[model samples]
Target: MDMLPVDRTNAECWQLGTDQITVLTTCAQTSGQIFAVEIRMPPGGGPPVLHRHDPSEVYYVLEGEFTFYVGGEGGVTRHRAGVGDVVPLDGGTPHTVRNESDADAVAFAVHTPGAVMEGFTRAAAVLGAPGARPTMEEVLALADAHGIEMLGPVPAQL
Candidate 1:
């Protein structure tokens, strides 16, 4: 990697349904130290499915509101976060993020030790090529192959 900045023009991007993720920094660029992505989440829906992975993640909300449900040893907790709010999720914690608002939301997600989320996104992008939307089962298989486990959608009551 050069000692220069990486903008969207030079970055990889992927679309997951209504959400778009732009890979700002890659594991190859950071030597597996870290990876980051900017996510644009549409209103009324975020990632309805809950998931857990080994790489820890931190999300900094840049716009709009979000509802997060996190599950750990202490049980599940719901968080209502908005612009400027930072949500840190430890490795292996099951979590789901949602946008119950009327407008889109933007957030930055950072993954420690790199390659994890980006790797999944790279493969997932293929599954979505030419707008071929893969089923949840297919996505789960891909996620499982990359050390991620999808724990189904968030409970409706939450």
Candidate 2:
């Protein structure tokens, strides 16, 4: 069994956005599943592009407000998930979750076995630098390299 101290304060506890940090409690090496804890984000923080996985996922909001966009060719459903709210997502469902509030938002997400959180994290790092945002071509290139499948362009509202 792997044993890691909880007090270890490292940057790994956070990820993506300049103001947000995502602590990973279960990485592929840890729990054999893609699971992580996401910490606060500023209002209108950027959301991930529309993408789908080969496995399912579930998200539980712990604090603040969040909007989950589950979309398809037909339409999109924006779920306003608050504390204690749980959003379960199935494979082949292109979706994204974002913070739409001024306060910090936190959530715990569990992607199924072999999901691409690590790759997502890596790609985010590569495309997450300051100044200009990465182009769609660049984003797809990174996602492709990481085994992620992009469904379409980023949502219009993002």
Each model's lDDT? 0.85, 0.69
Q: What's the lDDT of the predicted structure labeled candidate 2? A: 0.69
**Under the 3 Å rule for N, CA and C atoms, how many clashes does model 2 have?**
3
lDDT of predicted model 1: 0.85
The TM-score, computed over Cα atoms with residue i paired to residue i, of candidate 2 is 0.76
The stretch of ten residues in a row with the least summed lDDT in candidate 1 is 1-10
lDDT tens digits by residue: candidate 2, 1-158? 44455433553644466446565565655665765556566677645566776667788888888888888676776778999999998877888777778877777776776347665665576586666577778877877776678776555763
Ten-residue region with minimum lDDT total, candidate 2: 2-11
Off by over 4 Å in 2: 1-8, 26-28, 72-74, 130-133, 153-158
* Candidate 1 segments exceeding 4 Å error: 1-3
Q: In candidate 1, list every pair of residues with a backbone clash.
A: none
Clashing pairs in 2: 14-21, 14-22, 15-22
lDDT by residue for model 1 over 1-158, one digit each (tens)?
Answer: 36367767867778876788898888888888788999888887677678899999899999998889999777677898899999999999999888888899999989997788878888987887765968878978899999998887776776
